[model samples]
Target chain A: MSQHISFVQREELKNKPSSDALGFGVHYTDHMFVMDYEEEQGWHDPRIIPYGPLTMDPAAMVFHYGQAIFEGLKAYTTPDGTVQLFRPDRNMKRFNQSCERLHIPTIDEDFLLNAIQQLLLKEKDWIPTEEGTSLYIRPYVFATEPFIGVRPSKQYKLLVILSPVGSYYGDQLSPVPIYVEEKYIRASVGGVGEVKTAGNYAASMKAQKEAEAKGYSQILWLDSKENKYVEEVGSMNIFFKINGEVVTPELSGSILNGVTRNSVIELLNYWGIPVREEKISIQEIFDAHARGELEEVFGAGTAVVISPVGELTWKDQTIQVNDKNIGPLSQRLYDTITGIQFGKTEDEFNWTVQVDEVRV
Target chain B: MSQHISFVQREELKNKPSSDALGFGVHYTDHMFVMDYEEEQGWHDPRIIPYGPLTMDPAAMVFHYGQAIFEGLKAYTTPDGTVQLFRPDRNMKRFNQSCERLHIPTIDEDFLLNAIQQLLLKEKDWIPTEEGTSLYIRPYVFATEPFIGVRPSKQYKLLVILSPVGSYYGDQLSPVPIYVEEKYIRASVGGVGEVKTAGNYAASMKAQKEAEAKGYSQILWLDSKENKYVEEVGSMNIFFKINGEVVTPELSGSILNGVTRNSVIELLNYWGIPVREEKISIQEIFDAHARGELEEVFGAGTAVVISPVGELTWKDQTIQVNDKNIGPLSQRLYDTITGIQFGKTEDEFNWTVQVDEVRV
Candidate 1:
């Protein structure tokens, strides 16, 4: 799928932030990629232009009915100075799944990947080389139709923006406390929970705020139906090491299929570690802790890579995982993933995709 | 509350469409009310400006995280040529509820009411006086901060726009076929189902489209957990008159607390009709039909007022409601509501709020 994407470079690039000052989603690159979708013309006019504000109609359907979807990934500067992405194809495919669920038009994944590569090539200097810092790629689509009814939009826009960022949780290996949410639900089966749509995140902001107020950094969500089985964490897929085996929640239709999650599972399989995906409940984790079988707890996502859970507070009960420290296995998974991401280790899984210059 | 709202009038007004040609959400009025919110200044700079597109950053949190909410009501040209609104206070209150759920800051309901009234006075000439025609009012707020993380935005914008709309369902009394959705869920307990936020509507488009594909105009959603008890129809609250008694779904956490639904319940009480709010399962509705006691089925909302259900198709079973004709009770409710809205009937309920010309 060859897409003729036009490029309009910025006249003067903005001053770059210091590498050490790069925080999550705080700084943007010089240019971005954009495409438009109309019911009759489908998607067209793919272009890379200066990063700026978008002129949207006040009655745009997205602002009214919220038909928006997004994907999150990162580009890292390898030791050999090569800019590469980790499982971007998976992000694109999952983005398509979100589009399907949100009733938005799906894009040609290769076309989008090419667009990202071209944009990255143009903004190559923006990729921070400092350890624990990279360029975060956010590809999102939203309804742009100037209508006010409760229906799918006829017009849409797809945009890809880049932001230089540090560690999502301020540290690569620091174990953070997670609040087990019981009152508020994130997503339910037969809904858009499995897809990375905007509403699911919007619906979680309240619980996240309350958790933050209680000094917790993130939330551990449960199944909406029964509120018994454990789901994913705020923005990552969760894993628990119990006794001699590891277990994560099955993708029971409401959990996000994280690319980093897939990598962690594959890495465990490659190491011949006992890993399984099934309906694991929060009470079960507490029970395992009671039985001295709760070995470790960690979260996996593109932003954090691997986040070790130090403590978990559910209602009135609190349990500390691995003595409120990063477990050895968690450290190994983080090192292996980041090692491959930064080109410091072997790419045996063939997961990294190097960006090469391509003619527009 | 006295608000010092500034106004910027358009020098040349656009030509208005014929009243007969006005469809739902097709044509907009000349001016709109706008307000901004910042953590430092709170909500400031309330103004009325020419209707136009909004310039927003491509990284605006609303575009990605969908922290957007909106309310819908209508303004009618009474028989005496006065423009008035129907229970807009309820919409404002509900808008605050949505804001609380989405973690967006709330606004003073009276101040917003005044803003809407002031905007309506300026656009009063645009209100359609034709039979079954009125001006639809849409007030919405969204996160405008240019950030990309999974958190509530620090900056926001609230705007009110007007659209001259005909009857929401073409003929107000025409019954619409409803598809009973079992595979896809709309909202679950502990979700944002009870609020009028953009995510809930965005999460519903695929199911709505699928129902349309199956020749149904709307979808009747059941409880997400059990998928048995009826929740609501698309964009409306549903009620069933079984064995000559009207029963609607209670304020379950996942169901919207509709203003029109409340008005209907009150109206039924005013008319001495046996009415109750309880869990009405689809199977129970089917059983009522089996016993030849399903007297009427209708949906109530700001858009449709009272939409008679012509048929219900659930999996393999298809039931024709009232032989595909409008029921008497549905017609009476529509007449009473629209009558009060247009000032043709006695305002015994004091539901309509008159828009008075105010000093800026």
Candidate 2:
């Protein structure tokens, strides 16, 4: 019921990578947070221990059944050297939604948030202070129970690990090509598409690989039923600037409600820019491009924040947006979101949670 | 290039349960087959080591991305005191297909099959000799690399574990009620439903749990497009006897190509029974039942062999089949297939693979 903290440090700390050299999720921090769940004991033995390999039974349900859910956010360092997390509460809320969908038990959000604050303090040194670098936090809950039946397991394990990651895109704020996937589908309605679960990601590798092989960086998925309406991009929510209004697909239980997607929408509303979350079709986008109304297309997520799109290739037709350059609106939105994230701009929405001042 | 295997014995052997008490995937054998894969070294270090917990990194791709695929087959002991496998080559072939879909590297089928034979020899005593019991062989490949990008892992681990499993269904050959899932969808076209990947099972837990709560033993999933065409029953392929015609849904892109289902079709052909594989919708099935044309409904898989369905509930409408008892066709199919499995019937198709005698 209360925030519990226990620590057992490593005998020797691992060498840290230079801020410039660290890529995404390649280097890990010193300690990690872990908790276990049982049918009898609600959740027990919450502790932070040395980051290492977990000795798991080969029959563990997590490896066999794919009953696992995860949340991704980042710890950022400001100019004044204050460590903070942006909208971690949103990640926790979505994590519970994924747990419910995957048939895993939900955690006490308040207890977890408090524990995260203490963990951030403990690993504060690992938070990257480079221009676009940050410490990535991966909180995942998986079925640890060793069973093979096609049902939920009675036991689970919640683990939180940290990694120093560079900017998601090597070249910052540049536009890239995305292929319109016609054969492989990501998630259909009434499926686990909207949830940030492991299965959703596994179902998408083939499509991503095919698109990459065709010289596209990612894929643009469509609705499974008609294969016309545009869905989310590769693990990120997509937005299209058509004519003047910014259009995005609604949360139809077939696409993820990304945290960064919400922030972008809020920023657009504040700026009095027309933004709409409704069904948008690939044909409509092509028509808009034909009429020279398509301005810019971009993707939003915790990792990239905003990924500008330069060209979209569908069938045999390719359309270049904003003359294959980063549009003005995309650059402004990126600067605003990242500025608020790094605490350089005024916090009007109170989204950033500072680590050192929060009570554990 | 050649068949090679290293062995490591456990310091102490674990206690084995009685053959009758051995549940599915619970008790393990003394040793297992493990092979590692790297980008440069394609599936190296083949060994059979002590069966125990596997030490995995916290960020291992399997736990987070669900990039894992598996095969389910059993090793049976005959009256002649000889051990043999049933259609393991088919399982290996399917395993490669699953691997291709999941973007994981495939194994050398001959080398892996040779390794499984050696592993069975190493733990020959664990194979259950009871009439309905057999050693369940579970071979799985999972992403071992600890990176968090949405791509194929450069590193992977393939492991084969044996569990002395009892009969999958305790009642042997009995009829049970199944619910027709209308709300929660399973796999659809262009999805991973046809593959034995972990994500497909993960996507079905919610529907299965809901069906079980409604007093049904399993769920009968309809096609994702219209929710009318019958896709599969629980995790098995389904069949129906309508007016003396044995019918099953065709190999649509949305259902698993069950090995037992294939065998059942072959057996029906061999027996000179009328069997058809085509699009059979739930409405047509209901119409058949209304006109007293529906005779029986059943499910088939390697685990259950054949499961007779007594009743089906759709939208609060329950249809009892064959007076809530196993029909003649269902009974005949169950007996013939399980007969061949236990080595009683003639294997005219040459489905059995006898294990060569070897000792550690």
Task: Find the candidate with the highest TM-score and give its number.
Answer: 1
Q: Compared with the true structure, what per-residue lDDT tens digits does model 2 show for residues A161-255?
A: 99999987665688989999989888889889999889888889988988988899989999888888899999889999988889999999989
Give the CAPRI class of candidate 1: high
Report per-candidate DockQ: 0.89, 0.76
| Number of the top-ranking candidate, with lDDT as the measure | 1
Question: How much of the true contact map at the interface does candidate 1 reproduce, as a fraction?
Answer: 0.87
What is candidate 2's CAPRI-style docking category based on DockQ?
A: medium
Model 1, B51-88: lDDT tens per residue? 99899999999999999999999988888888888988
Q: What is the TM-score of chain A in candidate 2?
A: 0.98
The candidate scoring highest on DockQ is 1
Tens-digit lDDT track of model 2 for B223-258: 877878899998899999898889999998888998
Q: Which pairs clash (backbone N, Cα, C closer than 3 Å) in model 2?
A: none
Candidate 2's DockQ: 0.76
Give the TM-scores of the predictions, in the order they appear: 0.98, 0.98
TM-score of 1: 0.98
Score each candidate by Cα lDDT.
0.92, 0.88
